[model samples]
Target chain A: MKVRRSERLVDMTQYLLEHPHTLIPLPFFAKRYNSAKSSISEDLGIIKRTFSLRNRGILETIPGAAGGVRFIPEISETQARVIVNELCERLSEKNRLLPGGYVYLSDLLGEPELLRKVGQIIAAKYKDQKIDAVMTVATKGVPIAQAVSYQLNVPFVIVRRDSKITEGSTVSVNYVSGSSQRIEKMELSKRSLKKGSRVLVVDDFMKGGGTVNGMKGLIEEFEAELVGITVFAESNFSGCRVIDEYHSLLCVEEVDVQTKTISVIPGTYFNK
Target chain B: MKVRRSERLVDMTQYLLEHPHTLIPLPFFAKRYNSAKSSISEDLGIIKRTFSLRNRGILETIPGAAGGVRFIPEISETQARVIVNELCERLSEKNRLLPGGYVYLSDLLGEPELLRKVGQIIAAKYKDQKIDAVMTVATKGVPIAQAVSYQLNVPFVIVRRDSKITEGSTVSVNYVSGSSQRIEKMELSKRSLKKGSRVLVVDDFMKGGGTVNGMKGLIEEFEAELVGITVFAESNFSGCRVIDEYHSLLCVEEVDVQTKTISVIPGTYFNK
Candidate 1:
């Protein structure tokens, strides 16, 4: 009942992916496979090399004093596409999803592992863009901002729906959200980002894409370029100019929170 | 004038520390310092070795395309103690910090760099504890939780002030915060923690240490053992029940937030 090395690598990657910010000792894997520590190390090396070649992750070894190895999730292009498409498909069920034409993303946002991977995929896409910072509106956007900030090594800045005096001076902007019904206001701190800098925007979900456009206006106020935009889930059918360059993990068509039926489709960047 | 290599190394470490997840190209550093790329590489090597020896961080280099270097904040034991003492001193201003006898932590928590360092130190202390997870109560504690989780590579479980049906099911506990006169209820997910596992508890501020005690009770409910306890700031004058194992960066004395007068004392760990 021994697993092959390839099987082990895939299993290990999946396990580590599920357990972000965790280290698994070599002995643990060795015991699981009934193999020597040295053999496990060799297998890990192969996996590490594969990940490195694909620019997807890091396999870190802590030496001595009860040290082990950790895998930090950094996905490759192919992996990102695969994950996005998989999510899109799950979200594309029309009969289940399309209710009043608004996509319900509350469930996906609550999922820890999915959120973590979605963040990694977005960050990797903009890694080389010399982004000065990552920005998103408060509450729902905070998690996505956190993920992108972690991967990009840039500071995560929060834009507030309502301005607070404690944040010091601020710049404000207005844009219409969902279905282009009406414009909404959003504001950000003036000192949060530098002028002529590149900024990456991320959000948990987009309906009207209005908030995304408002964020863009706020960035423009600071003379910063909106280098990239990403959302965990977007409704492509919304027909809004919320994002210029964006990637979505899941695209929703119809969501009925009442009936609990939702339809999902593979995102545009899926499996690319 | 040209900067010395040591200054560059220190600055490099600080810059890398501030940006935990981003990679810096060799050219970026070389351009900043007006040095050759090869020279910059040599400087990075020296810093990397020093970082490893000091147990301050992990400096990783990525090869080609989307490659550069990243500093993962992993402090050494001595560094951990030093940080705890610093926090203790900062919180020591007894007369100035007292706004109804509550030490003002608004300034400390809001500083990005300080919050980041505090998180790294806490994570460093339990670097090998096999922390099935990091735990903290909500609101002010979220930042600390985020920091520790980033360093430890574990998902931080947030104990909420109140439970929502949206959270599924929860286990509730009663504990008195230092600032509050009455005992308040806190909750955690019924499925959040595993049974008989080891957990590290962290909080932003500790006075009566009642919240920590409450957390201990919650852990017991899951049959988990308390591995350790850590606080960013500790008030020695509070005369609270001392945790079996704890660390603080700064000590606060009677603080007067209105008068803006505060007393600070470095902790013993600083000299370690």
Candidate 2:
């Protein structure tokens, strides 16, 4: 496939991010891009060093039979700025978002490159904190929480709205979400934070901050302290009752789910 | 802190797996274990080479203020087997686990060390599948799914039971869970999966296998192919009809929630 220098860097970064379990043979990227293996190596060298110099990532190369390179999910502010700017530009087409006051984020969430950048940005903020764990309610929260937990080197715990037989016994809690609706929820027994454990809570979106606040309450019940709260995006329309130590990757101001017109500004967290 | 050799390996592995965002300063690990920095570096060197030799992971070292060694989550069958065996043995306590019709995996899922290993194993299986994303239904599936997604460096997609304002518009699905008395509800975004995308599905426990099959249907609806399926533990009691191409880390026979007794054998996939 035809590619640009920037696109190649993105593709290479994306590949390493997706294959954290195995190294990519150096020749592999060369063959994929129809470039000499040596040239590919040089390109990777630049990208790797650039990432390191930026304090945004670590490019690791494994030697011998099973050796290749892997990309650690670390992104610097410069990288984040480039990505968020591109995202804002792409989603700027307000007319395409459609009625129902929501812009479709599935495509972006599915992008490996975008996810890596977002994960790195969120993880950077809480790097030194004694975060015992990372928490998010189930489903959409899994991806964001996974990214953060991966960066933080901690197990991620999920809180559920209802109990499933799979979770075994659960600890339940009730809280009012950003929608101002009180909801009852339960966390898997093994998923509870230890007494006085420090946790960082993350999610995909914050419409009312209710879900995140509820998670905070549940963490408190386990004698854990909330170290930080982060979201992929926060709805500007919602009243922000979320804790002071919070971050967002994006902010949405005008969401016309019915009209399909959504205005999204880059999240303030990116500037940090 | 008192540390076991095996536990040291486990902890190092867990530490590396959890912190894919940055390198671990050699001095930091040295202080944590009250060992010499040189000794810590030596241990890390062994780990780095072992992972590289096995085609499982990469050890990246940073040279300065922004530098440290980081372990990207990846392990080969041999390494995975070692960790998995330890996990089964540690959790095999019959008294600690309940015996009934289900297996109590809460404790295992809750512990950071165990969770990290579980994530590594699952991510190892799909190391080269070129998965665009990882998906799991709400509640119990979040942790496992998050774990796998983190190592794979892919975005995690959570399927919710009910729609929330934060998610905007969603596409709903109906499926029968293996143990549930009635058909259950699940949902994802209409825009989550792109056409012809490859998805890896994971869950915490498998009893009836209804939810997984339901996810398969959703994948098909999105015109995406199900690349693989994995679970932490699968129950032998439920004559469940799980799709053919799935794997489980452990096999559980019975769990008594009240009596606190459980029977868990290693999963058949462990042999493979």
Candidate 3:
């Protein structure tokens, strides 16, 4: 059915937001709205300007035949800072400090709004890079990876602690567990990644970066290229990490369980 | 910042799509767009009409001092049928059959677009219900749960196969694994839910419905109410299932490993 300019603007914005980082030919929208290419172009212009003014994202237009508009989701540095600072505050809560020096993160990671914010910040860092997939270890990192995948319009694969029969063939890698300093095994399905794929690795927390190193190993095993590594938070308490370069949204400066006091600061991501 | 009506419609539509199931008072949009209440109302009317005409969702308006509008996402029956049919064809692939009568579903679940559609379908079913949270067992169910949670604009709590130290205190339940017929333990963080909270249980697959029942046990332990149960797929080869009432998008009738044949049909969700 044909739609007027107002209806087109509303529906077009909704569709673009849902499908970030993907190219949609103008004719596709033109046909769907039963409008001419010229009118569709005008509607996209409004959406693009509004998106930019609001810091919602970038609307990239490709010219000529087989070209269209793409929504590249982004977050302004100011908004990103606010979100990270708020997360630091939440992380510093005394009761969140659990035994074994690990703070409770289930609640924070479960919130869709928070996850999306964190995802936007982290995704913005690699928005310009060509990332074929988002990789994360199973359980906690699943939510974060899923959020980023949605923003990047990419599929995410989970690397599990233990292999499930349903995953078919698997690739296993062993690395020292940062906290325990003991060798641990992590596995990803052989079918999850194609060789030479560019992968971005993300996780909920980082200590000595052992888990990130472990995932790096799996990426190597699969013959895939590691585009980058980032974590939601990393502990500053660790003196040395296996992987030196990475991005973190929050840095845990201290977690004094005995004193029941925790300190968190914005991550090195800002410093970079 | 002040904006014109065209820009406001574009931005307003983006905001409403991002924050589904949340009530945003007219004054909020009015203030955000720096427009008069009357103008905002007119803009919302246009958005509401476009939303309905596109079958995108329902833009519900409430009139009162504390009233606002809520976006309840919806997927039309026609689109839902098309998506489910495509899923059936994909699941019936000969290579998808694995040993132990299991099918490889990780690839399908990892997809953001397909998962969003599935999420919309499941979320549409319970959009009107009072659901405090959506619950699923890790690790495959995480993506599906997150997608649905996005649609419903609610938090999702994951039930883990094994409790992690980071989860703090957890409540564990032992259920007989449908495929293995052995008792398996699943756990949920004690803080993930509040007592008497209304919960919806979702999973990626079901055979004898052991996992769903296990989640129900956790919900019972937490003193929460079970609003509903649903799955992405269910195997029907088994003559009996512990669960009789549930919704499934796809049903697997047979997975003949020897002959390398697989059969999938649309699930009971459509019939109901």
Candidate 4:
């Protein structure tokens, strides 16, 4: 396990990136790398400065017997805006407009790199808030929630439209479906979230915000507090939204089915 | 943003980590960091050495007009075994056993740190293959697939038990449920995957391997090739497996519902 300082720096950087928001005692790294405490501290200092200059994240160093270093993944507003604008351009493509005004977003969401950027942007927005877990509905929302949760370094809970035997006992709630305008039931395992936990809700796309609202109700049933709501894209043509407070990366103003035209703009993320 | 060599190294490391399996021309980094090509090359050398020593991944330097550096995320066999062993210990907890022999694994799969490790291990297994996308079932498998796809820098497609309007046209396939011994239908959006793709199938848990087989059939329907199959854990008690070729991180040897006991061991990953 003996390694040089240069090698140590590389390993430490990877380690810190993987364990964001978790405090790592200097002694642990020192022991792991078979290095002196002073050397470990120097390596961390280099990492912290690099992370800060690039706005990659914050590396806080604590000075105490029980203290260590922590990596907080964050994205600068300028960088986030640039990313959102690019996303807006991609989303405005006429081919994205599908039947019934639904947009073809699976391609964008499926790309890991895009998801990572989106996750970083959303996670940076809520970095200052205390979040216990991330919540999202099944299928489409899973990747979005997973990305945000990865950046926040918290467990994500998946709420499903149907109950599965493997989930054991689940708490189900009925809410009005946004597009369908029909009562729909969503369920979450009782063990997924603990009582009094603070949860952040994320999704791939939002139209009437009914699905997000349903997740909000599920949070209450779990006796948890909603920290915030974020979505990759929201549709302005949905008329009225059930929820008012939320953050979005892109906003779709119009989708003309006959003309095969679509208009997209940076979402609330830039407004702030 | 003019940065020092130390700062450049940190940023370069982060960039390479985020963009794995993709070549970045040295000039790009030189321009981005406002540094000379020679300086960037030296920085990449340091990163390459560090990554190799730590077995973090491969930092390949491709020489030519179009070549630069490519980061291939990898984990050594020794490291993979240790991680799988630790996972086996966690999976052996008696409390994880749920009703009808189901295991409560939502927590482990939800943790970003753990998922990153699992993803690295599984991705390392298929690093040499031509994998265009990672495929998985909806709900539990999304995170695992996302993690692996993140490492491979590829998109992931989810096969869902139920179809949503947002997914547009989908292709459906029927398979026998391993646990319930009942036939079930799974669907994937027709546009989610492209024909002639080499897809790596992944799942959170496998019992009879029915779902994985169904995914295999679905892959054939799309005219895509199956690179391999990997799962987080498989139950040893499952009488017979439908699929014989696969890799698993951990194996649940015994889950005594009456006695409230569970036994887990390292899976085929170590055997290979």
Candidate 5:
């Protein structure tokens, strides 16, 4: 359809935001908007500059016959720190402390805005990596994985604690639960991942790192590579983590059950 | 940040996209951009007109001392039909037919772009309603709920088939599994939702409507009102649906296991 330059700019901005990490040829926009290639190029130039100045994302322009523009969603370090600190403060509230020294994160994780910000922060860290898919355990981890996957523009695979008929054939792995130190099984659908795929593992909480390790084992069973591991929060109280080399947005320094208090700090992201 | 009008427009577009169905005062944008309220108003005018003309969403201008702009994400009927038609084509693939007459929808649901479209279509239907939260059964329905919640800018609660310690103090309810016709229990955390909320129930698939009905019951137990029910797809072959007054994007006309074929058509959305 025919469109004005101002309208084209707005449409292009929306289009780029929706299709992050995917290359869009200028001709595609030129044809869609019934505009000239030169005009579309100018529109993208404005979008690219605005995205960078606002720290919204990156718009990379390629110069070649087979080249196009790509949008890479990113969050600045200042913005990331602000978001994490706010979360830490919220988490430190006495009401967030649950039994067995657990901090209630369901309410925070349930919010789409918070999830999106968390996803952007996590995805920004791995933007340079070739992540084929995101992996996380079911229930609590689904939203985290979904958010990160959305930013990275990749599908997320969920590892379930129990087998379901709906999932068809699944590959199961056994590992010790981080907090309880009890043996647990995790399963993933056989068709969820292709062999030799690179996956980034994420979770809502990491205590002993046992669940993350279990997910690592599942990735191996699928013949996939574990690019990296990250979690929304890592407990300072858990004994001896089972895995190393990971990233976390927030660290639970203390959860005082008697006093009904919790202490949180910015995680490894800020330590760097 | 002392941004130019062009930069302000781009940043504003990105902000509106992220914070849909929410209001932002003019002074807030003016202060952020280091610009005058009049300039911010002009920028919003450009954005509002572009959004409506391109069918991106609705930019409502609330005027008064406490008034500002609210972005309500919307999908035009024509665009919604096109999106649903594309999904129908994808769902009709023979390979999607799984054991026991199930159509594999993980791939489609896993796609962020497709999920965004589906979410917009579903959210558009309930945009006028007082939806406090989006509710769905765990596992398959998480992504659908997440997408819809993203559009509505609200939190989503997941109902689990099996209990977990992570979700403390859950409210469990027994309902017959639609496909198996066997009694089963689903649980939702007591703290997941607030009482007297208006919830919109969503799922990836529906057959006999037993699961949706169960969720409706769960909503009542929480003292929340059921605003509406929506599914990605519903089975036409199911015997006697348990609930009425629901919306679906697609209908599964046939899932022939012996022939390994599946036929899908536009659902209630198109019927209207």
Candidate 6:
């Protein structure tokens, strides 16, 4: 059956959004819509124009027999700053303060809309880099890694503190805990990360960068390259972080355990 | 700026996909596109018809003064079966089988595209239910929960085996480990879940049903209702499952340790 242009546009939009960072040849869409190449090309032009006009994302068209269109989702700097500013307010809630200067982030991270936007911000920043996989420690960092991986259209690896039976053969690394100043172990499935792949590390929270450092070491053990590391929030309470090169979406400038006050600002990524 | 019908359809499709299970007032779209209601409705008509025809999902338009449109992401029965069947093949790979009847699943779960489809399958099963949140026990379950929550447009709560300080005040519960017959503890932040919430539980794997049973009990302690429980795969090696009523997308029929053969079949959901 012949497909209408409107129908073709909607279906094509959905497909591009679903398969981000993936190239789909013109013939593929033409056959799916049972339309001519010229018609499909026309539909793509409209989509490309609209996507750019709305700042939705980038739609790159590669010309020639082996060429196709690819979608690279992006969060504009203006939009990212807005999201980070809003997070600062949410982090300032008095009830989020914990006993030992820890700020509760589970509630904020649990919000789906917030997580989606946060994922967009992080993925947008690294969209141009050659990232093979997103990596994070088990438990808190899993969700963030999954979110970023979704946008990048890449697989994610979870480095666990405790090795489970289901992981099969594994690679383990021991590092100094940045917070406790004690030795800790982290491991990943041998089958999870490819040798010499580029990996981006992400986490929900960072303090003294112990966990991030641990992941950096584990990456080396896998023979993988550490492309970058970013966190949702980082605390300066420890004053001495083992890893100096990192990006954070939100920064905890101070947490006054004495008065139950927490001051948070935009993280190391943005200009203050 | 005046938005054309074509642009409106593309933007609307992207917005609805990102915000599934959400109601968007027609006027909201009209204002966003700076178009008339009649034009907006016509654009929606194109999207709705295309979505249903392509099996993308259901586009529900509620008419009246307080009415709007809602997008419910779904996977058709045939599509779900295909995914489950493909999973059977992946699970049956000889290398996935490990000592002690365990099957390595991290590689499969790490795939973003596969995880998105799995999330859609699980979300479609519980799309109509009043799911306040998607809950899963940490480490393996976090990605699954996040994926399902993304489709359902609901927040997800992580129940950790060991509580982290960032969780703040938490509610802890002890249950007998289904596989080892040993008692283990689980904890969720007190603020992570609201009382009287209708929650859906999901996980990466199930054996002996101990973890699911523990979560079931934990749900009751929170005064929340267990709307449903689903697992990516369930192993029958134990020959005894603590939870009787649960759904599995793939089942490990048998694993021959001596011969190094693994037999997997479509999970309990299919009639095979």
Highest-scoring model, lDDT: 3
| CAPRI docking class of candidate 2 | incorrect
What is the TM-score of chain A, computed separately for every candidate? 0.67, 0.70, 0.98, 0.97, 0.97, 0.97
- Which model, 4 or 6, shows the larger TM-score? 6
What is each predicted model's overall lDDT from 0 to 1? 0.66, 0.68, 0.91, 0.89, 0.89, 0.89
lDDT of 2 by residue, A1-272 (tens): 54434334444554554444245798788777777777777667866665565464667788776788866545567767777778766665664464445555655655445665677788777754567788887666766776666555566777777676645567777776556566555564644567888888898877777788788888878878888888887778546565555788778767665555667788868553
Count clashing residue pairs per candidate: 60, 36, 0, 0, 0, 0
> Which tens-of-lDDT digit does each residue in B152-252 have in candidate 5?
99999999888877777889999987767999999999988899999999999898888999999899899999999999999894577788899999999
lDDT of 4 by residue, B1-272 (tens): 56677777777888899999998999999999888899898899999988887788999899999999999999998898888888888887887788888888988978988999899999998887888999999889989999999999999998988888778899999999776789999999998889999999999989998899999999999999999999999888447778999998888888888999888999887773
Question: For model 4, how many clashes?
Answer: 0
Off by over 4 Å in 6: none
Q: Which ten residues in a row have the lowest lDDT in candidate 6 chain B?
A: B236-245
Rank list by DockQ: 3, 6, 4, 5, 2, 1
- Candidate 5 Cα deviation (angstroms), residue B216: 1.0
- Per-model TM-score, in order, reads 0.56, 0.67, 0.98, 0.95, 0.97, 0.98
Best by DockQ: 3
Ten residues in sequence with the least summed lDDT for candidate 4 chain B: B1-10
Residues B77-109 of candidate 1 have per-residue lDDT tens digits of: 666557656665665544323325565554455
Question: Which of the CAPRI classes, incorrect, acceptable, medium or high, describes model 5?
Answer: medium
Candidate 3 residue pairs that clash: none
- Model 3: lDDT of residue A154: 90
DockQ each: 0.03, 0.12, 0.90, 0.74, 0.71, 0.87
* Candidate 6 per-residue lDDT over residues B1-272, each given as its tens digit: 88888888899999999999998999999899888998988988999999999888999999998888999998889999998889999899998888887888988888899999999999998888999999999888888888899999999999989878778888888898887899999988998888999999999999888888888988988999999999999887455768988889998999999888889998887644
